[model samples]
Target chain A: MDLPSRIVITEEGPREGFQIEPGPITTADKIALIDALSVTGLSQIQVASFVNPKHVPGWADAELVVAGFAPRVGVSYTALWFNDSGLQRALAFRGKLTLAGFISLSASEPFALRNLNRDRAGQIEAMQNYARLHWQAGVPIAKIIVMAAFGCNFGGDVPAAKVVETVSDGLSIAREAGIEVREVSLADSMGWATPRRVAAAVGAVRDRWEDLRIALHLHDTRGQGIACAYEGLRLGVTAFDAAVAGLGGCPFAGQPGAPGNIATEELALLCEEMGIATGLDIEALIEAGRLAERIVGRRLPSAALRSGTLASLRRKVGP
Target chain B: MDLPSRIVITEEGPREGFQIEPGPITTADKIALIDALSVTGLSQIQVASFVNPKHVPGWADAELVVAGFAPRVGVSYTALWFNDSGLQRALAFRGKLTLAGFISLSASEPFALRNLNRDRAGQIEAMQNYARLHWQAGVPIAKIIVMAAFGCNFGGDVPAAKVVETVSDGLSIAREAGIEVREVSLADSMGWATPRRVAAAVGAVRDRWEDLRIALHLHDTRGQGIACAYEGLRLGVTAFDAAVAGLGGCPFAGQPGAPGNIATEELALLCEEMGIATGLDIEALIEAGRLAERIVGRRLPSAALRSGTLASLRRKVGP
Candidate 1:
């Protein structure tokens, strides 16, 4: 199948990428990375997370980072908010920030408790309450991120039925709360998804939420992230979440093992080769990788930066 | 779709894996690795190459290595022969080797000159003449590998029509020469193949040769090997060529750039998790990885070994 003509990229380096680092990043570095990413032609950037500071100290200065950036005209700066309390924090800057609320429902009771510190039902209730509060406060939830939609770390294979049910539950809550979710994203939280599984999940969600814009947030832990993205692109998913330099790993998902999410440069290369216009500057993306590496005080996991692309290799060795 | 019932893994650690290393590996260590691999339930092993000693000094003692462990029930020991001359060398040790001849036909004039020192036509003619000679000598060419079937460094995007025409040509030549070709493999010499391209190529070949058993030899240079394998598996392919600990490279293809074929342990894990049986002992495979690292005097590229599997990780970290 031919690739899509225009593919939208959502840089997750500021939010998801920094959240999984070993130590907290200073607000200045976070803002610098996001500001650099804004000029890289990304359609959207997950700028920060509004989760509890204690839970994710790396994102403690999320508000400052969001306030610091000079937002680009076409690029949307998004922040992730978890529950009613997080939504309240997001609402304080709702008119000034593009907010994205995350809700995960794939885990069973035990896994949910371990990962989210709540049962599945409790998590669902928390999302419902957040949706109601956002509606009453006139806040726009830019995207509803469905985490672990493909599979869970503790729970082996998340059934497609459960994912469909969770989307349905979220839709019902949104309808009752009188809030319209602008887009929905399916995340392969633990990187346990295959291409076929990703296709099936995306297809199921799209079938239910026909009008909701779909995005895919994939982790490359098992080296299948690009493949999964290819499949998603084939299934008409144009937006994706990627970390610059492939920095970051899930503290819970990749505790002592596991690889991380797909790198932004690698993903852009894939799209570029397939004739998909991602509008990302490969050279600039590599520079962003260097900036990320400097902040982290070590090399990131980007293979494209470490090992140049095929086109670059061809040029370096001469024709 | 459910994964196939079983996957046939052809371990190429002994020959391809060691060929590109900087230092020399002792004949004893090579033999020990082959023996260790045998118990890991590999269906077949490319034990050694019968290339000229000048070309690859590492396999200069290929004859002795084959003689050391020739008789093994149920596991085929295939040796790679480059041309009619290498086929002659292989025939001398026919009593102790299961032979397979390799012919690369995916490159245009320039790349063919640099990679195989022969153009596409010259390579095909060499294979046809070698088939005739092998038939006369009563040597069974168990497999015929067509390298660079996906894409070539100098010549990009190997046309699917070219691959089909070349395979048909080789099959005709073998039939007329009274030599039976048991299997044929298509390799991604520069690792430039995507899943879509792979599916298209494999599907085209399958359409033409319904009776021919097909295998894929893929490199992970661009991290698409596993995804390509998954696509081929969905297309009903049973056999694959892999380098244990992911050790191998094609210097002519690109330097410090050409990654090895997909790791055997990763393939086994994918098959096992998808409900396919490879009969491979994952733990034993990790042991082989350790031995490979020691032999190569560096870290092997096997992800399963570096980052332990979920089961092994749990065991290492204690429940």
Candidate 2:
């Protein structure tokens, strides 16, 4: 249970957070917020999702957002894609953005169909197609996100074997298509994972693919995200995905009451307190949360923003 | 970091939760809810706090609530005490309720004075008096809770050395008064503890006091409660205190926006998923959350109650 000395957090507020909002946030606001987050010492940020506007109206201006975004010197900006059309939209960005190709596989066929518009095999095939197209276009597929890796909304008990199998199949397809795979991001889309479950999955994958970099995209829908992240860190999976202010939820989960991704501020505080070097300016992160609250016109569920950081708390309550 | 086979979870909704609430929840409603929780495989519940009604008006009817409470066999009900008068009130219950004595302390003098109306030394002296009185009366003090064990709202950075020193001083006083100490519960009163901090404090205490049982009373204000609990578990500390539906916040923290205790239902789900036996009926616990929401006339912050537990999730998303 030895933890890593450092972890990489990827901010996903602009895309995931904004997509679940009731109304569209102005492109200017998105650009401004993303720009603000770019300097927060995060290694990467998921700026926007290149999905169909008909499906998610809030992200309709993805192109404009990506175009207007000004990346910080050391931080890489990425976007998400679901299918060929989404990939095409991302490819249109050419070398401007690092495209994070997504393949959501649920051991449950119904969930796989409803969420990914394909069964497990079909989804793997689509990923192969996705890899082939990127290869044909001479573009690199930076990462393939295995969504619902823990458990799915329609699929019960996504076994560790299934997750490993899915990742292996996706990677095998990429190898056949001659596309070099960068990493695999295991997402707890339903927020159904616990620490032990995370340990088992991450351990199994890490043991099998020793050299592959593993990342976690966890949600706090069931209040287990932070604990899961701690377990992931113990397992030495460094990259994590979080949203500012706990801002996003799965629009497809049919549960509006579900919580968003783990708050970046909270995660930063955890990392800092654990002696893990996140290099995040928590003051800047809290300010970003405040800005998000102002833009969303409501209170967010981020605890660190409301409670203040550990150092601030210590100073505030000091003698 | 081997986890225990099982952990003890103490439900504190009626006592801690009702105390912070604005309106009066009738004795009948309180009795009904406690009775319902009694059958949910919970070993213990803090039914009421014998504090002055003038301070926490919601728990004004502590005597009446205790009188009306119907405890099931094998379930131990306890009441919290601040001073001798509260102890006298708890003593009236005689064999019916286990008395839990509380002494609020802070390394910060301002916090100790403002919160407890006494400095740390004075608070320890009062605990000694409480122990002598309880022993002379032939009544056992089931547990002593060290409030603000991590950090205080007014006292910043409660060092591990300070926590150990406080506990040692309190224990020394009890021994001098010829009282036996059964357990020590650490309260993260303002919910500022991170996992490593919890590890440090719990590890220090466990190393120093190996035979004494350790428990954690955690709040989720900064969204690190479950992870702290995990760290405590890893350190071989088993017992945890949680409100049924994330129900209680510190009225003394000055910021009402701070969150409540970690939800019992959520914690149960974590333990169940981790193969750590809690013996809690999560379905019934979630029902308790619903009932709590009904009594409070608002939705609680418990994520498991909102999104459903792992079993329920698997069932709902099953073939």
Candidate 3:
């Protein structure tokens, strides 16, 4: 099958990867890492999440991290926000950062309640209000994320139709605020997605909304993350969410040891061999992974880090 | 994007997984593991490899291991042979076992010499002689394996043309021995293959040898093993080689810590989600993975084992 020649890799290692760690990472270290990633040719990097300090203490220094970002010419430093309080903080940095709005739908009612403290209907209502508030503050929402789009921790197989319906509901809110919904991301938050499910969901979204740009935010919890990304590429998804050093996991995922997102360098390895133009320097990405490992003080779960790339291996053993 | 509805999974964990460990596992442990895998509905299990005992001390008791297998009715218990001496040992167990012949082509001359004590031409000649001897001894040779088909540890970016030429030479040898070549396997021994390389090579093989039953033996060294398998399935390969508990690696691949073949349970997860029938019991395969971890005394590189499957996760967090 013909695949797109270029794909966008949105780095989440600094933000998502850092948040789930047990203790705090220094603001200086976070800034240094983001600055290092800036020169790695990524089009976008999720620098921090404007979350409640009590809920996510590791990112309590979000303001400091954001202020310290020495922006590269072409890279957009982005931040994620979950509620009104987070959105207010994101809006405070209006010109310096791109605000990322999130809306997660749990396929299982129990998961919805446990993770978000709201059922699907209540979550949708809350999201509609958030969209309106963002619009009032002059922040136009272009995309919304749908978490657990494949399957859920509390439910085995989530229906694709439910995910599409949830996206439609989010899009309706965007329409109410007079904002064009340009993108929708399907997140395997629990890493419950397989290639077939990814293809089916992406295909369903494409069929329903023709012009909308689709992206995938996959977790390696089930080992099928890379496969799902590959399937997404075949189905024409041009953007993906990944972490450096394979850091990050859902705190409410019930399993604390579940793997993080697909490692950025691992994804780049696939793109590099496929001749897909990711515009990433593999060496720099490797360095970023090393920095992540140092920041976390653990061996991160990156395959490329564990086993060096084919070229690097040859260099070591070359005649 | 039409795909085949079913695929074949060849289990190699018992032989490949066990052989690489530093110490010896009892003959009884090997037998028990193979017997457990037999019930998991695999069509083929590579039970042992007859190599130099000094080189692979793990399989030194190959004769005892082969004699003890209580055969499953439908499953073919197979053994791998490296040379004339190994072939002689395999012929002794002819009635009870299916012999698996292997010949690896290293893209780098140094790798070929260090691993096989042969250059490209010499390895081809040796493979031809082996094919003739096997045929003379009444064992029909129809399949040959080409390792480092993607890239090599000592040489990066192995030419696809070289792989095709190597396979062609092996087929010629089989034909010379009056054996109709029916199967040829491409092995990413160093785990360096990507989806596009897999597609390109499979497309080339399909274009040339239209009716050949192609197989892939992939390693997860670079973390693209599962993705490569998915691509191969899209391109119409029905057979795959996986190890139980994600075991097996090239002893000469420069990095001893590199990952082995794709985990069978992990592959089953993909197959189950894709709706491709592999006739394997996933729960049984997972149990087999746990057993492998116990035998190897380390956590095998299987995502399914670390993070339970969707079904198991749901069970844990379900209402």
Candidate 4:
């Protein structure tokens, strides 16, 4: 019941969806969705991922998408990049986007090996070099991201200790580079997180680093995303990473056609209904979800987009 | 968190799915689904709905479905009906099914008007007749169903008082019929339930009648069904009604393509993950969900079915 009065959502639909979708989704369409999400009172939006086009052909037009979309005044636009080459591309648009480096590590070693082609030591070495590059380029390492924080397809149930160890690895890398990170995003990359697992992982992380603000990057792959979000809220975790219309899928999780991220429209509804202000328009978010569906030329996994928000229903029903 | 040690799941996939599908679904397909659900360690299954063939042509073969499926030992198979004709139809299969009448009333009058064509007063009168018929036919009015107990499309926000009043009205009808109903099921008929609203309605009913067992009939229309169910679980509510693979939709809710009940597989996962025994085989349930998708000739709304179960993941990862 210790729900936060307000929660911050990082809109990841554009970045996540376009990266995994098997599409020649026009550059204009990608810009259109990001522009649509920009007006929904979202404080932050991940507009594109600067990954190699050979790996993810969907995000090939990343530069066009970033340069094309209209960025709002209050919204902090962000982008995802793994290596220095990707980072340099993102750094090209410094003012247009809020650039920060992430010490991203996978909680499960097997998951890291499959997705990143790196073992535990190899991942740490990569991040150590990544941290130094960010330092030399003067980009702040804002957070430590532990992928597969809950469980994994390759390694199965990830103990909270594994998450802590991952974070510790990230922290050591940050320390070597003389950088301080305050936030940690626990990602359910394989969609294996339940509420109980969320509680355990969040609790374990908090027990180790009491001052580090926690963020959940949950997937709806098994449909427990919102419930897991609810559990996080109960624990007073304020930051979440979500996709509008549930845009993103784990390309490396070995689950195809399973849902991607939790829907931002539904998560916002869950918050607003419980009297927790999301500071976003529910109707507008639903419309954006519909727009996302149209862009992808298929219905996304979000049921809320179909049923609509309660605000509209209340208006129809009257007082 | 006073979670129930064990919970009961009533598999309503056959009845709920077949009723709403615009299907020329064969009677054989329907029985095959029921038979699949029977071996999944479920204790109760709602096999079919006996309604007018002219209105709901999908369930025209309800008689054949009930007669066709091989009932497993220790499993209680049930059927739904609104009037005496439907009840008489169910009575035809006395030994084949567990026959119990439900005093189903809508908490919202306008919702009742749209769905049942009965106002608050008219609904009471109809249920009075319903109870008497069940008594005469040797069927116990086992529970009072409060539909739209959280909120409704036609009727805005249903207050806790309204739900209590609906339950009170049902109790009076049962008392008049000399029936002692022990259970009250609060249904999110149009999927307007949040955890807070569930707590309110569930608390209101329990405050008035602490002795009665509470059951939740949650729909995943807006994707908050599992979260609401988690809230119910925390409140020690033990019984849930679910559709395998999220097979049903509200035909009268003015919502097209919206998901119906929460998928039984996901709900069972939620319970089992929380250490609440559901006595359900998670793997078998996932298989049933897939079978449901195949029978419907389309992908159902359940993400868990596609992702499979954690038990499989554990096995894959090994101990």
Best candidate according to lDDT: 4
Considering DockQ, which of the candidate structures 3 and 4 is the better prediction for this target? 4
Candidate 4, residues A65-121, lDDT tens digits: the string is 999999889999999898999999999999999999788999999888988899999
TM-score of chain A by itself in each prediction: 0.90, 0.94, 0.95, 0.99
lDDT of 2 by residue, B94-125 (tens): 78897655544454556679976887678877
Candidate 1 residue B160 Cα shift, in angstroms, is 1.6
lDDT of 4 by residue, B103-214 (tens): 9999999998987898989999999999999989989877999999998899898899999999999999999999999999999969999999988988999999999999
Better of 1 and 3 by lDDT: 3
User: How is the predicted docking of candidate 1 categorized under the CAPRI scheme?
Assistant: acceptable
Ranking by lDDT: 4, 3, 2, 1
The ten-residue window of minimal lDDT in model 4 chain A covers A16-25
Interface RMSD of 3: 2.2
- Candidate 3: Cα lDDT at B237: 86
Per-residue accuracy of model 3 over B164-281 as CA lDDT, tens digit each: 8877887787878777768888989788788988987877777788888899989998889999999888887889999977887767675676678998988888887787889988
Steric overlap count per candidate: 0, 1, 1, 0
Candidate 2, pairs of clashing residues: A317-B156
Clashes of 2: 1
Cα miss at A130, model 3 (Å)?
1.2
> i-RMS, every candidate?
3.9, 1.5, 2.2, 0.8
How accurate locally is residue A111 in candidate 3, as Cα lDDT from 0 to 100? 68
Report fnat in order of the candidates. 0.08, 0.79, 0.75, 0.80
The reply for model 2, stretches above 4 Å from the true place, is A100-110, A317-319, B100-110, B317-319
Candidate 1, lDDT over the whole model: 0.74
Instruction: Report the C-alpha displacement of residue A73, candidate 1, in angstroms.
Output: 3.3
